[model samples]
Target: MAPKPPTAVTRPPISDSSLVYVPEDVVEGYQERIETGIDWTLIELGAQHHRRKAINREAIPTITFSDGLINKINRGYLKGFLDDTSCINLDQQWEQILPATLWDNEKFATDEGKILFNGINCLTDDLIKLIYKAVVTGNRDTLWSELKMAEVLRVNNEKITELDVGLLEFKKLVSLNLCGNYIMDIEPNFIPPTLRALELQANHISNINSFVESLPHHLIYIGLAKNLLTDESVDAFSRLPFNLTVLDLSDNDIYHLDPLLDALVRLPNLTSLYLVGNPCSVCATYARLILMVLPRLKWLDSRQVLPTDRSLEPYEAHPDDLRSSYFYFTVFRVMSAPQPPKPEKGATTAFHVELELPLLDVERRKFLLYRRYESLTEILAPPEEEEVEKAISTVLRPSTKALSTIKGIDVDEASSNASNVYDHLVTKSSRVINNFTTFESNKIQWAKVMNFQEPTVKIFCPDLFALRNTFRSVITVNLVYSIVYAKSGKTEKKSSHALKMPTEQRVVLASIKCTLRNPDWTQPSQHFHWDDSLGTDEAIHWGDRDLAVIQYTQAPVKVVKGKPEADPATSSRQLPPENLTCHFGFGIETIRAS
Candidate 1:
C-alpha cells in the first residue's frame, strides 16, 4: 500500500501529446505519392498560364501608347474626373482608374497624341479625343470643330520655337497670349479669325510686317513690346485693319516720327497708342507733334491728350509769313541849280547816295544774315559758344548796316567852276546836305530813336510803343518822301527827271504820323493809317520845307494831302511794309551868281 502511494505522488499526470514512429517502407511510399501530386499540380498550372497569356495577346489592341500620349490621357481623364459630380472627393479612385481605362487603351495612344497633349493643358476628354482624332488623321478642321467653345488660350513661356498652325484652327479663340517665348517667326494664317486680342511680347519676333499682315481683321488690341522692331516694321501699322484700336510699340527701334505718325494716321479708330522706350519718345515736342498730326489720338505715351495741347500753336512763324514780311531800304538824291550855261547842258542833276543804317534787333538780323549767306544746313546747325559770341559781336558792330545805299554826282561846267571857286564851301555844303538825308531829319522817324531796322524792326510789328517821356502812344509810322531834280531858269517841266545841274538850287521834305489796324504784315489782311484823335487819315506836306527858291520837278509825286475816311474793310493799324523795297532822300540849295 505504501509503494502505490509513492508512485502516484512522484509521476505528474501522464502527458496527452507524444511523437509517433512509422515503418520505413510506408514512409517511402507516402513520399513518392507526394512528389507525384506536386508534378501533377505543376503541369496543370503551366497549361492555365499559357492559356491566359494567349487570351491577353488576342484581346489587347496592337497600338502602343507613347509616354506622352499616356500623359495626355491621364490629364484628360483627371479633368473629366474632376468635372463628374460622382467623382468628387475621389481623386485617389481616379488616379488608380484613369491609367487603366484610357491610357491602357492602345487603340488611341500614339506619338502625335502625346505631342498634341504636350502643346496644350487643362482640356476635357472630349477635346482630347477630338484632337487625337485630328492628329491621327491630319485633319486640323476636326480639331478646330471640337475646340469651338474655347475663348482664350495661353501658351506663353512654353519654350516653343515655332507656332503650330493647327493651334490657330480654334475658331472660337478670342484672346491669345504667346509672350515670353523663343518664337521668332509666325506663319501666315497662324492666328485664328476670331481672336480679338493678341500678345506676342518679349519674343524674338523680327518679321513684324508679316505678323501684322497675318493678323485677323477683327483684332482690336495687340501687344508687340520688347521685340526686334524698327521704323520699317512700324510702317506695317498702316496696313493693319482699322478695327485695331489699341497698339503697343514700346522698346522698339523707331527713330523717326514721320513714318510712325503716318502709319498711325491710317488707324482711324486707334485712340490709345503706346510708344514709351522708343527713339521718338525722347524727342522734344514729341507729344505735341503726335497729337497735332494724329488728330484722333486721345491717349499718347500713357497720358491723355488734353484740349489745350491740341489748341497750342507753333512758336516759329510760317515760311510764307517770313517771305512776305521781310524788307530793306536804299537812299538816293536830287539836285537843281539857278541857270544853265548852254542848251547842251541840263539844269539839274540826280545821283545815288551811299549811307550806313542800323539794324533793329540782333536775333532777327542774325537770322536774316544767316539765311541770306548760309545754306539751310548751316542755319540749322547747333551753334558753338564761340559762334554765338561772334554773332553777338557782329550784331553790335556799327559797320553791320541794315540799309545799303549808292552814291554819285552830276554837274555842268559852270557849276563845276563854281564848285572849284567854292571848294571849301562845297565840302561844308556837302556835309550839310548829308545831314539832311540822315534818318534823324524825319521828325517822325521813330526807327532812329528806337534803334530799329528792317526785318528786325518787323519783330516789333506785334508790339505797342509809346513816345519817349510822353503818355501819347503811337502804334505805327509811315516814312513817305522822295527826291526830284528840275531844270533851273526853265519854265517848262519835263515828265522825266535826270542827273544834271544849273547855277542855283533848293530842297523839299515831308513826314507824318498815323495809326494802323493790323500790325501783322505777314498776313494778307488789308492795311491803312488814320489820325488817332481826328479818326481820319493824315497827310504829309511835301513842299513845306526850310529850303526855298526851287522849281518843282517831274518826279511823279503822288502825295496824300488831307484827312481821308478810313476804309471799313481795311485795317487801320500800322504794319511792317509788305513789299521789301524802302526809299530815302535828301536835298540841297544854291544861290545864283549876281
Candidate 2:
C-alpha cells in the first residue's frame, strides 16, 4: 500500500528548535506517561492534564530532543553513532563532517573548522546531468533498464527539441540508445563517425538527409523504420560506400520502385535487403517485373508466384469485379558473330578466325547412320568447300571409267588428307600474316582465314579435337591490308617490292623463327640464326670500285663498336644506330654477259 501523505496526523506538531524551550516539569510528565501502564484513571488523568498543562505553560509549547530523548529509537543506530570517538562537535549543536584520519590533528578539533554538509535531493538538475554523462561516456556499461536510475526513467522517453546538452566531446560515442526520445530533427553536425548501430526508431525524425550526410565511413548499420521518409531519400543512401550491406527502411512512404534499381545493380556485395513491411504491390505484374530485373535477389517478401500452366479449381463465390490477369514474358539471348577487327587506316591487316568442330552432344561409339548429308555439308563449308564441289560434280557425271577409278581410291582417306591441309593452311596463314602486319601500312597488305571440318573426318583415328583446342581460340581476326603508295597516278605495292617477292603475289610466306649470334664478327658469306629473320640481306657490289657497304635486313638489328680505341681521336665516332637510315651505300652492280 502507498504510504500516507505527509501531514500533521502522521508527524508530531513540535518544531525542532522549540523542542529545547519546553519546561522541565512538562518534559518529566511526558516521560512518566510513556513509562506508566495499566491504569485507566491515570491514562484519563494524563490526557486531561496535558491539555490544561499546555495552556498554563508559555504561549507556544516547546519540545526538546537530544541524545537521551526520543523513546523507542533504534538502539543499534544510536549505539553505533555514540561509540565513534572521532565525532566532533561544533557551535549550535553541529559537528564537523570529515574523515576519521583528521581526528589526529589538534588544529581541526576547533569549532570554527567544522563543516555541515547538505544531503542529496531528488528535485535537482545536477543529478539529471550526472546520469546523462555516465551513460554517454560509456562508463555505465550495464543495460539501462537494469540501472533502475530515477533520472533515466523521467527523461529518456521525452521529446528533445534542444540537442546541445553539453555533450560536445562525446562525438565518437557508439551504440547510443536514443530510441524512445522525442527528437524531431537530426542536424548534420550532430552525427558522428564512430557510430555503428544507431537505433532512432519511434521518434519524430523527419529530415534524415542531414543525419545521413554527416555519417562517416565507420557507420555500418542504420535503422530508420516507420518514419516519414520517401523514395527521394534513397539517393542519399545510394551515394554511400558500397560496403553498406544492411539497411532497414521498411514501412515508409516509398511509392515508386525505379529509384532502387540503379543502386541495387551496383551493390553486388549486398546480401540482404528487407522490404517486408513496405506494402509493395504483390500482384502478378509487379512480381514479374521485379523478377525480370533482380535475378540475383534471393529473398522475396512480396509474394511472387511462379507461373504454372495447369488450371486450378474455380471459385464458387467470386465477387462481381474479381478477375485474374495472365502475364506472358519472353526473355531473349542473341548476339551477332563478331566482324573482323577494323585495321588502322594504313597498318598492315591480319585477320584471325577460329573453327568450332562438330562434336556430338553425347559421345558415340561409331558414326550414326541416321545423320543426313546436309549436316555434314554445313560442317564442311568453312574448309572443304572445294572438296564438296569436286565430289558433287563427280557424283553427277558418273562416267563408267571414272566411277571405277573413284571406287579404287579410298574416299574417306582422301577427305581426311584434305581436312589436314585446310587446318595447316589456316594456322600458318594466321601466324605469318600477323608477323608481316606488324609494320606500317606503307609496307604490305596481309589477311588470314580459318577453316574447320569435323574432327571425325580423318583417315586414321587421330586426336583431331586435341589439336583443335590448342589453336581454337588462340587468334584474333583482323582486316587484310596491302600497302600501296601512289606516285603520278600509279600505285605500287611497297612491302612486296621491299621483300623482293613478285608484285602479283597476295602474300609472302616467311619463317620468323631463328637464333641470334654476333652479326658484326661473322663474314658476309656466313649466316647466323635469329628468331626475327625476315629475308637475306641482298648485297649490292660495284665491280672494280671502292664501295662503302651499308648493311640492311628485315629484322630488328643494331651495330655497336667492336671495342673502344685506347685513344679517343682515332676512335671512329659513328652516328647512332637508327632504324631508318639514308647513309649512301655502294651503287647497284650491273653485269652484262660479254
Per-candidate Cα RMSD to the true structure, in Å, reads 46.6, 42.7
Say what the RMSD of model 1 is.
46.6
lDDT of 2 at 558: 41
lDDT (Cα, 0-100) at 260 in candidate 2:
59
lDDT at position 404, candidate 2 = 38
Per-residue CA lDDT of candidate 1, range 221-311, in tens?
A: 9988766677667677798877988898865556666667877898888988887655454333345456667778777656776676563
lDDT of 2 at 358: 23
User: For candidate 2, what is the lDDT?
Assistant: 0.31
Error of 1 at 177 (Å): 0.8
Regions of model 2 farther than 4 Å from truth = 1-156, 165-168, 264-268, 281-594
* Highest-lDDT candidate: 1
